[model samples]
Target: MSTNLFSGARKALVASIATAVLLGGVTLVTTPYAAASTTVAAVSVSAKINAFTNIDWLNGVWRTGAGFSIPATAANQAAFKAGASVRLADGQVRTISRQQIVGANMSIFLDGAKLDGNKVGAPQVVTIGSSVVTAPVTSPTTVTAHSTSINAFTNTDWLNGVWRKSPGFSIPANDANKAAFKVGASVKLADGQVRKVTQVQVVGANMSVYLDGAAVNGSVVGAPNKLSTAGTTTATPAPAPTSPTTSVIATSNLNNFTNNDWLNGMFRASAGFSIQASSANVAAFKAGALVRLADGQTRKVLRQQVVGSNMSVFLEGAAINGTSLGYPKTVSVVSTSASTPSSPALTTPPATVTPAPAPSAPDTTNGKPLLVGVNLSGAGFGPSVVPGTHGTNYTYPAESYYKKYADLGMPLVRLPFLWERIQPKLGTPLNTVELARLKQSLDFAQKHNVKVILDLHNYYRYFGKLIGSNEVPISSFAAVWKQIVQEVVNHPAVEGYGLMNEPHSTNGLWPQAALAAAQAIRTVDSKRWIYVAGDRWSSAFHWPHYNTQLISNPWMRDPKNNLVYEAHMYIDKDFSGNYFDKNEQFDPMIGVNRVKPFVDWLKQNKLRGYIGEHGIPDFSPSALVATDNLMSYLRQNCIPSTYWAAGPWWGEYALSLDVTSGKHRPQLPVLQKHAKTAHSCTSIGPL
Candidate 1:
């Protein structure tokens, strides 16, 4: 909900070079434009974060539980240091942290993690986030022929996983009736069955084909069979198209593209993506619209098409360059005169052309902004199965607990990982069991299309001493962070790391040491958002000095820098709670009277912060009053907050509400009411 925040110095770049543009063969570059203009807000919006102007990634402070993006540019450092929202993209005009947005010169969000785009060898390694190669700008279309081709076959529709172009789509298919395949162009098959043709049996002069050594239907390549891909048997009847035509998964959004000197595809060298088209696809594209993004040249729009919830755009076909078949084409999309277009994917993009234009500089969505997220441990629930099916650790009701949270439409989730169970021993490292469980959980997050924060929960020690031991040595802490970085950092649903659960410390050294540990992570993992406890009792107002380094550290540089200083909002006990004492009771004025101070202080220092911990007690629905008050306060101030937990606890505590109890407790209604609002909390809904 709360993403990039930038305020301050304006970035002025002369993207135009004062030289004659290069024109190869029929391709010609367009004149550059160096102008600025404001237009009506478009229905399509994008946010982009970058590393420029020597920016600071995490500088904004927490207002209630929300974080503001601040500027940290050198020229605007003073103003950014003073705390002011300069300007962020997507009409985002909010004050951010000094380290994040230097007076509006930068922004921060948990989008990418552990980026590695360098080429090591055959597999061009690109870690962190999902990589998209933009080429052959697709012109949206109404033609379902391509879709119908695959839809026409279910079990026979090739493999049941993602299909990628092998060594480019240029490889000609043995089937003369079908068009040539493109390089690297892949499709995901939902259900594909393997067939085996071994024992040949004659049934009254009739023959059937066997799949996986079992005959399902009488089928085989009719007529004189081709030599390459073998299979000869009785021809089977064509299957009726059960689903809609066309089998292509609509992946029109191109963010970062690279390949080709052709103006056919899309690729964004600077930020986001750029699109162009293949030469052959371009000629075909002329039937629709043809244009290229100045940044990337990966696509060309071929036809206008409609897709998604309620969006319409030109549909474009992607065929890698130099990938085509000389065989007579059966697919009507291609022209006969065409030498058979080659596959669209090149070895590496055609050449590093200009990148795609940065998505309207990363900024938060407009209107009164409030982020909602769920904690799986308290307010939500998954399956409460008996025994652990996969992982070696004992299974509880937690998995079933998540079902309720997902139903409640919780947008953000903080799923806890019991360290004692994950790493029962001290020196022994993570194994395949833990890996599989983590993968399954992450897969759940992705399937549900929600954000999840990996929560490490436990009281364990590494290197012979507990985590918060003397000075909290950096080396020991790094070990903990390294595991997370390697294991789950790249998962799309995973936003970033939550260092410790209900984190605390009496000595001041722990916070600084943790800060250092985070900084070390920054050295390798650049684009992840990190949540660390504030200080002492995990309160934002606790250690002013320790919190200062997060703002004043040397490593706090880069538009991708994402660090969040977290604090607990529990007015009572941690997991189990009675209810807030009269002192911290429900107050309609909490946002203004209490939470405002925290916001104002964050504004003053320009630091990003969050309320990472808190929840209601068991059997005490009255706690809803305080929860609503706190939630209301956050909404009023644009603070993003996550509820205490998701999974239901049978324990008799006020803060530990079970989502699946189905009794509709008092707080359930309160939470339900808020769920209707876009800015309401999402950490405590149905699984």
Candidate 2:
């Protein structure tokens, strides 16, 4: 066997990913990811033959000029040793079986018979399952035998068949944990670290990998049974998890999530929160009378507003990047040392024989606080563009539209993506065949339920006018959200980065391409949640009251809540202006009394405000009484809206109550009259 097909082969793989910044001053200096460029470690030379690409080393042993003694189980034996040389490693394959004759006084001559010691130089490693003697044959010689067969594994190693299956049982790729074994099941890995796959590469979305065993690249089988159509491994995706993480605990308290009451999840806080002002930590738990964030991860509590005793926690759905200057203002829980009277290794618990384990508060009926539901006007159902034409068919499947809003209890789904079909091939990267069909629609919006604000319709002048670009530059639109959050914000129901659509400075570029794409998405994602798009989206002449002194700069305070401020009320088109030149005294009751100057600038900037994108224009005139008098003046001015066209407009310009053809289409018996789908966090916040 002789092989050397080097049409160029170099490889070095090391993935450690660690990004926990909230640093502020201390001489900052980030931007470092370009490492992987190595490749030169395939060295296994044997005294002298270096000339390949389909190999060339015959006369050395293929017959003549010097020494040789080949026979290690010799059936198809090959060993050339004129000047004795052999090299193979990069994609290895070369079978010689035996031979050695090196320097000044060499000695070896196989078929010509002459078997003894020192011969030439000294190296060894033939190949009948890696035999020996290529250089180190300095003694007797008579190894006439050959046998080969390899494979072993209980935990792993011996076989390099890289296996992956991820679904709800999402270990290898997507499932994470439901619907057992899949694709011809029996896929057991993680044991002893196996290594013999040789080839298996299926990537992105519908996924199907499997190299030598054959499949090879592309086949999540047209994916999308759900995980919101296989996209949310928890959005903002990019090779996420940079790793400062030791004990990021909080998953299972999305603003007050209450489920079939069994009990054990914490955080119901109200009075300025306090775990004693936390440096927050609670390890990967798993004992469960109530120990969650140890795994199902997704427990957080702070869209900012907890001051005093401070409070911070993580894990329950990762990405706690910079809760305003990286959390933990002041905490110190060190007091645990008092049980030393040991005795009872085998028999002891009978104080009446009780103790079934008790201590749970069913989150006091989820006092409400974490809700991440982003579906921005492509509302309820709208990715259908056969209208004018440039191809559009993601076929509504945000994991079955968030398991029908998690079976109507509704928790979250703010997911939108259209950076011109996710970078249509311009600067080269992130097209992975439409990111594997948008990861089967973000794994069907993270397997039925809710939590995923990944919105970024990125209107870089409409992707510079469908990839023609007249001026698409805001740092190439922050490198299309730093390359789709560097390839999708590492899952947990993705709750971050909603910065671009409806942003405006208009033909002039506001706040410098919106503060340079919000400081380049907080300089490569600094702690999640960053939805800032007023200008024309939340318009009262671009709502943001001249950035009210950039909220005492802490990058506009509210970082911990991770910043959110958008306002849009097109109250029947930019808050009704002329009732025929103020004739009817501008009635709709003075256009609902001019929304108190943008609700007093969202309580003077403690802002987490949202009317995030609106619409109500399906031929206006009391369009469902102006959409029930504009959601009863935004629930009596506490303000929270998200309606805009689902097409033939029932988004009433505020958009889709679910009626594409008439009689107010369908899903909105106007939110079943006086809207408020199940329980309440007082109207979605913290996620």
Candidate 3:
């Protein structure tokens, strides 16, 4: 027989024997022919193929039988169309013929014969273990196949542009190799060629992958040399874990404060952060942050809150401005565990400052009757003349002198005292003898129910030098008054303190000295009125020309408002009592007209005025008319006036009202008439 016929006959016999084995156990007759057939069947069984329909079972070694068939599916057809090698059960490996899919079945063309699917039970998948097998790729193949062998590759279609792991590297797109690819695993990049995705930002139309490790433009996988997802690729780094946040408390400074929004109860500033007048800042302050004020004092921030974009830090217990904070200042933020130290006390400004509070307004009678009084200088002007020698001491009259005046129905007396007599030397104790004389007069006045205006009878000087001149400091004058007040301030008969007897030659120092003395007197005695004389001999005619700053400025204000401006007026044209020699030239209305400005100024400034000293020479028609007109004007204005003098030494002097011998001067009746209305004076007839 030919080799072909024998091969065909053997294949047919193997098929028949397989069918018989499937039905039941085969009974073999012990003969030479039967043994030969059995041996052939056994040989064929050892070389038969193990077929599989499922792809997963095709992993290990498999063999091809004598009549192998291929599946008609595209995945199978494409895989076998490229001729594949497979191991037989007998350990013999052979190359399978290329196959193709025809409709729902397969067409196999071997060596020189064509095989169709009709002879096979179903299309078989021929796979082998330990070795990769591939077939000739048919032209116009509709699908691509993946390997089923241990060394097989992954389908590029299955990759679909994914990242896959390679040896120490990553392929970032579709790749044919499947050595180390996984679903969700991390892998390393190429050795010494590391890369990091610093940022993944979207560009105009696509995402830009920025890498810090290497200079590569990361684009989609379709580009040349670009990595694809199908291949083994390194994995991206996991995102870093988030860190937790911490909170802290802080404070703000006043210098940085921009504005306070009162409506919102917020304080805004240039500082980066704002503090609230409500919770946090307030709580922190109560918790103890010391705020230093502009006055160099520290206060706790008692309340604070944040409203809108502003902060409200309250220095006082409540949230307010000015009184509590006073002025904005430095703030020290203290920690919770620390204790705050006390702040220094705020100091008050001196009273001489210009912006000080105005003194209280003087007593207001609201258009009451005018008061008449007398000026007496015997106790203050001098000592009894020492033959031909000048003496610094003054010989004041005995207490009976004042008693006599009080007995004459004098309600008030302007009693003068020399500053030199009271304080002979700067900073020395007041003269005891002079003070005793003053006390004696005060006692007499008090016994007789008369008010005494204690006068400092100096011509704006202590010893022929101006009070505030270089030779005699104004401070010394103030010291003297301060001492004098200590002695006489408590006396009930002391109606007021006359700041000066007649301050001429002051040269602008009168205002400063007067104010100083008034302030000094005020320190010890607040209720008693103070008579502040004007500059230039307290002249009524010169009142307008005097520096009115002393009365106008608040700094010179007597805190008690018990100040009466004292002005002196003489009826003569020169405002000098020495004009008694020219008494014939006196005009009754001239004195009244000249004093109008002084009265108008007092009214304009809402002040009180006292004519400390004013007089006409005698009861002549001109003198009486002048004196009456002056007194009538003073009465109409409700101003108080005191006649020039009744000193024991002024005997026969012009303008003197000396009654030592019980004889009445001609001007006495005019005085009694005007004064009788204000006090309890006797009604004396014309002299």
Candidate 4:
């Protein structure tokens, strides 16, 4: 049994093997034999024709008989070039080229004409040098020959009814053709030529058939009927399907986001088997026309569809079949005058004026109410450096720490965890003890109705090897995230998955790895928001320049389109949150202006921005004022921000928001001011 070489590139190459067959030189023959005889003699010739370029012409007309022979002579080349014509077995006259016949053995067939000692009359058996020639009697005798090689055909009874043309030929595998050879049979080539098939041979686990005395190793032969304009034959290719043209209707910032923005600006609905309109109908849609929805509902456009602007009809209560407009629903223009306008009924007021009802509170659980959050640090940065300890121990805050902050009206918390603590060894399940400690903190936050953002605090490296590098495969990083997300993704308190804490690398490796991790998380939980950060510690200053590669990567986009870009901003003169010296004093408004470019970029791309970490030092009036101004700026722009931290390890640390001397840090008052405007998690509300 031969193995099948019918897969991948090798299979495609084998399927195209017939094209290569025209480039090689081979021979075919016909012989005259007795009709009653069951046995036939064969001859095999192995020789190359010198400088023969017209292999197609030779394959079509060359045949062996008693009267014809091509001689290796210069005069024959001259005669052929002058104007000589050869009559083919089918009675068609074709001009012969010198390059096709020089030094090549050939045969000629003449209708009703005799040559040499052989007579052209009926199907007869003729012997020549241990080779048998079988001729079928017709208006012109059909000449046939057999091969003498070990794998040659033992009979020639199959050459009876096969027909051939210039580019089309048919050799049905009927009983006669099958009986001619045991494992293989002779078939007519596309160029009206007969070729013999002998046996199937195995070469390196692949099956190959010998055709026309030549080894055709795994080459694919085309159907005989399809012919090329050059008089050569090839497989007929399938026609390609046409694609619809896409037109951009709008481009705008996140604040101006509308239903069309979420839909990626695709507008067209199906009508029977075709789309109702495309770019060609843009003029109609822009003229306040009626359009059909995919669900067969017709709605009138309230206003003209903006071509290069960001405007939404969804705001005008536009919907299809009671469902809100979204992606994959095609919309098309119907009529220019059709229109539907929304009107609210007015009722007579009572003698005393009653105040209108208050608007319902926005969903804060979805990260909507100006995220005032604090970074919880102990679990992720590893165990504290304590005296007389090996530093291998892992530490986490007790429930009281979470309770105190929850009581302070903080609505969101950013929780960081170490990768090594969860998975000490590659490919192993998350460590049971470490997972329990992390879950304990998460449970405390849920008790207080505070949402948590799980942060993977690995800096794009594991065990001293950069991810996506030779040392650690990017798949390994994605694998750990898959396991981690499965454990806490469904937790009610968990709001979003922060793919990584910070990535500061080059050549787009950080974004590449971030995309891999984000995709892995999406596989488990598609609805949860995922936070993706750029390289260089997700710096706000270099966001536009350094993160260009990531922002442009199509793969970096989330399938759900629920991604929030995370960036860290610091306020010192050097843009580092290290110190707050008096000499480095700068106006709070100036600091806010410095970070506006990043905010503008986020708005322009229609992407949500989250300040994952930012902070200030001390309770001085100058520092407190700076914090107040920056927080206000972020809130006004609808940007969610989390303060740098409050943890058990920080005792009197300058930037710590932790309680000290039984009083809240000064930054708490600043945070509380912004929290008052947001929906509170605690009954006490903002201080």
lDDT by residue (1-687, candidate 1, tens digit) is 110110000000101101111111111122222222222121121122221111111122222222332222222222332133433322334443323321112222222121221211112211112223322322222211111021111122112110121110011111221111111112211123323222111111111112232222212321111111122112122343455342211122221212332112221121112211212222333333332322223233334321111111232333323112111111113222212233343333433333223322112212122255666652111112212243322332344445565556455667766554455444357656766666677787666555677766532233224565663444656665676577776677676677765444334455555666677666667766776655444544343543555455544422245655565554442222333242343322222233344555565655455666555533232244446545544553445666654454433223333533333233444454344333212221100
lDDT of candidates 1 onward, in order: 0.36, 0.34, 0.48, 0.48
Error of 2 at 620 (Å): 40
Please identify which of the two predictions, 1 or 2, would achieve the higher TM-score against the true structure. Answer: 1
> For residues 1-687, could you state the per-residue lDDT of candidate 4 as single tens digits?
001111111101111000001111123355443233333344321111211112122222222322333321222222332123544333334442222221112233333333322222112211122256443322223244322111111111111111111111122222222223323244543344555543322211111233544422111233222211111111222222234322323211111122211222322121111111223333445434445544445444444322221223321222222233333244544432233422221122212222213433334544345457788766764322211121343357667766766666666788877776778777889888778877887898777776788888776667656788776888988999899889987788778888876677645677777778888987898877688876777777667877776766775553344678888776666565654353465443443554566687777776677788877655233455456556656765667788877766554555666634343354675676565443212211011
lDDT of 4: 0.48
TM-score of each: 0.41, 0.23, 0.44, 0.46
Span of ten consecutive residues with least summed lDDT in model 1: 3-12
Stronger candidate by lDDT (1 vs 3): 3
TM-score of 2: 0.23
Task: Please give the range of 10 consecutive residues that has the lowest summed lDDT in model 4.
Answer: 11-20
Clashes of each: 161, 144, 37, 16
Q: How many times do residue backbones clash in model 4?
A: 16
For this target, which candidate reaches the highest TM-score against the unseen true structure? 4
Residue-wise C-alpha lDDT for candidate 2, range 477-515, written one tens digit per residue: 666777777666665455556666554335435445545
